[model samples]
Target chain A: MDKETTIYDIAKELSISPTTVSRGLNDHPAVNKKTRQRIYEAATLMGYRSNTFASSLRKQRTNTIGVIVPMLNSNFQSSVLAGMERVANEAGYNLIISQSLETVQKEIANAKTMFDNRVDGLLVSIAYDTENVDHFEPFFSRGIPLLFYDRVPEHKKCTSIVIDNIQAAYKATAHLIEQGCRNLVHISGSLKVNLYQERLKGFKYALMDNNISFSDACVISTNLSVEAGISAAQQILQMDPMPDGIFVSNDTCAVSCLKTLSQAGISIPNDVAIVGFNNDPITRIVEPNLTSINYPGEEMGEMAVRSLINYLDGASDVAITNTITLRSELVVRASSTRKGEAS
Target chain B: MDKETTIYDIAKELSISPTTVSRGLNDHPAVNKKTRQRIYEAATLMGYRSNTFASSLRKQRTNTIGVIVPMLNSNFQSSVLAGMERVANEAGYNLIISQSLETVQKEIANAKTMFDNRVDGLLVSIAYDTENVDHFEPFFSRGIPLLFYDRVPEHKKCTSIVIDNIQAAYKATAHLIEQGCRNLVHISGSLKVNLYQERLKGFKYALMDNNISFSDACVISTNLSVEAGISAAQQILQMDPMPDGIFVSNDTCAVSCLKTLSQAGISIPNDVAIVGFNNDPITRIVEPNLTSINYPGEEMGEMAVRSLINYLDGASDVAITNTITLRSELVVRASSTRKGEAS
Candidate 1:
């Protein structure tokens, strides 16, 4: 790499003080317009870059946000990242994102990286088996705004943004019951994940409310991959009394299970009514158009960044706001709607 | 924010020279093991963070790789990013990523930000309408390793990692023809992108080889979005003589078009054989299962970063290799197998 041009060099070339060159570079009103224009032209001609890293070090704020996600390939996580990137970029902040690949060890490494980088704030969606969040104490002690979004840990200091997973799950279960499903099955993610655990609670509560009692065999815990969905479907097929309703915690898994059952000659919404979370694009393309919960991934992403930025700008105190819940609703589609009066 | 502890503070507390403190932190041979262990303990107790910012400025290398993509919400892009993150993180380099959002303006802004941040190298996948390469002049002038992948610009100084799109497209088209299709329609992304243009060339060449003269009517230039797929399907339905084959540049659009056509009572393969690019997970869930080209997105990402890092480490010269093409294969499935024996 070539040695970069400095403000002092530009000042020397223009026969002016270095302070004047710095002021002109910053577009300070104290520097005359003509002098600022001359400095800009010189900077461009000389390939001079006003180093954001050095200036950020001096100012004690990098104006960059660090985001650690469980995975980058998921529909909901990517959507959230897209929205966060939009808001952060619009606010003149760069986002440094890393995927933990669903490992708490990797999450710890990523948190340490963000701390070493001196990011203004940090946003995280914990890994699947992240039992403790002590790795984030450095950021907390340094008074850097730290916030969590989906799949959050139970932390007092961090503000968490999430949809009402319990309510959404309850609505999905209630709808399946309304569709005349007597025996229902739930395909859940890891019980360690707060969201999935809450959804399980909702599922059990809904069954109790509907005067139905189910055994452990009715619920299958999975990593929610497509292959897992296939295996879950195979397990359901082996049940003496097949499940009439299925609620999956993710769209990819639900679609996979639905396809597997359909391939085995089961009529959707007749033999089985299914509901999934995260209204991913796959829901519409699948046969019978899957019913799903409209998890606002984009909104949740934007809100996370907006909150962090607000706290950074002193416009709001994110510390006082312990938990932030975004509204989510159930979307009823043909896959879960059994009683149709018109058709 | 609380005042960050520096090595100088540790030195003062340990009653040691600043040089000894720095040497101990680096685990120098001169600074014995016991001293290093004590230094580490003190550093941990005082929350002393190594100043990567100042050291990076002195070294003129940030250990950060900047990446610019057109979007962050796509399956292929996310997979590519995942691969890039894995490689970069393993190599002790951080990736600073930004999205162009399919616009030249945002790309230019992102480029400037990367330049100002003094990233060690840059990886870019150009936007839809980025006709000029002047915005990236700083990287070129400064001897920063610049690599482009997937959607790239025609720049001699930059190394581009991509699959052979022309061959992939030719295979898709020839497969459709072999499935007994006479009239064909292609759903393509913006031609401003080099990959899409090369695919178009392949499509044209395939038609000519099959003794079919093509026209503009045979191509549907679209953003390849779901809505565009629906509109394209409407256009195909209105043809006086419908096309017997369809090729879409992306799986998302292809699946959407297939679903729309199926909903309109068009029997796939028998009526119109379809082939799509990028064998995303969605390809398998669609009713007939999609026929697609397996583009090596993960490999492409790893190759881009590997090339940049090799150049940085003086292990290889990337500028000498202008283009590195990865292998892609055709995945023929139910969607394009009309005369098949159900195998």
Candidate 2:
């Protein structure tokens, strides 16, 4: 690395006071326009870059937002991040992102790193295993605004942005039943996650509304990965009475499971109707295109950053808004439209 | 925002000199262990988060790497970022990312932000219209290591990690020819980008080798988006002598084109054989299973970061390794196999 040129170096080279150089670089009103121009030219000639770290020490503002996500390799998360980036960038804020790889220990470590970096605010979609958020105490105690999206924790000090998972799930389940499904199975992610737990509730409620008795065998909890989908399919195949319908937590798993069941000679929507959450692109390509919930990932992300920035800039009181629910809708596709209906 | 606690606040509360508090905070050996413990406890009570900005001012190191990508909403780029995060986290470094939105202006703005942040190193996949890299002069002049991947510019001061686009394209084109394709259409991205230009060259070379007549109309330079695929398919349908095969730059575009063609009563492999680059998950899900080049995005990302870190740490001279080419393979699937061969 090359030696960084400080304001002092510019001052010494230009025969000016270090204070004047610093003031000029900062565009202080006290500095003369001509003198500032000279300082800038000299600094540019020396390749003197502004040390944001040093400037932030005096200003107590970094103009950087910290973002911690569950994983980066997902369509939903990527869409959310793209939305966050658009809002944050337009507002002249940089986003520093970290992934927890679905573990609490890593989440804590990531939170610590964000705290150490002194990010102005934090946006988090916490890991699946992050049962509690004692690690985020520093942000609360120090009055750093934190907003959670998608997968969130309930806290008085934080604002959460999410879609109504239960309503979406209920719609999906009821749609499957309307398509002539009798016995149904719901493939869920870790029930520890609020979204999955709420989805489980919706599935039960839908069954009850249809006068069908639900049992423990109706729910299959897994990690909600592509591989998990295959195993869940195998488990479903071994059941005493086969499920006529299946609803999965994510499209990746749903698509995989659908393929496996089809390879086993099961006709989609004839033998089994399927519904998946998160209308990812994979849903469109899969044969008998999977029915899915249109999770508002991008909107949720925009709301998270906008709320945090609002709180930071005193434009609005994010504290009063405990949770902001974005709209989610069921996208009925070929996978669930059984009775000779077009997708 | 709340008031931040400082060492001076601790000193005043504990009735000790500010120097003692500062030393204790730094874990200085000169400070007594008992006083250090007391200071630590008091600091915790007061939410005295360490100001890394101030510390970095003295240390002249931030342990942060800046990454600039074309787009975040891409399957290939997401996989790359996942790999980058894994390697950077293990190396005890933080990643700050920005997207160019496939524009040179945004790319320039992102570069300035990274420079102002004083990142230890930078990794960039240049934007679509990035004709020259004069905007990257600040990093170049400051001698901060800059590494490019996938999309790159010819820069003497930088290292690039990329796959052999020409070889991958050649293999794809040759495979289609082997399957009895008389005339082929190449759906390419902006020719301004080196990768697309190389692929175009490969496409032309394969046609010349097969003794087939080619025209400028045979090549379609597009944005390579899903919408672009539909438009390209329309163009193909209007050709005087319809091309028997197609090779698209990305899978998203390829799948859309295939869907459009199929909906228009065009048969796959029989009417048109197709191949795509970036063997994304969508390739497998699409009907007839798109044939594509397995571009090693994760490996490229890992190699880019590893080289930049190696350069920053003085472990290796990335300058000597101007360009590092990772392995790429043509995964022949049903889309391009017209000779009744299995995938």
Please give the lDDT score at residue B9 for candidate 1: 92
The sequence of per-residue lDDT tens digits that candidate 1 reaches over residues B72-173 is: 988888888988988998898888889999899999999998888888999999999999789999888888889999987887777889899998999999
Task: Show what share of the native A-B interface contacts model 2 retains.
Answer: 0.80
Top-TM-score structure, candidate number: 1
Give DockQ: model 1. 0.79
Candidate 2's residue-wise lDDT over B1-343, tens digit each?
A: 6777888999999999999999999999999999999999999788888877767778777888999998898888988998898789889788998899999999989998899888889999999899898988998777788888989897777788888888888888988889999889999998988999999988888888889878898899998988999999999989878889999999999999999999899999789999999999998888889999998878877877888888878899877898899999999889888777755
Off by over 4 Å in 2: A1-48, A238-241, A339-343, B1-48, B339-343
Candidate 1 global lDDT: 0.90
lDDT of 1 by residue, A141-208 (tens): 87889999988999778789998899999999999999999899999999989999999988998999
lDDT, each prediction:
0.90, 0.89
For model 2 the local lDDT of residue A205 reads 92
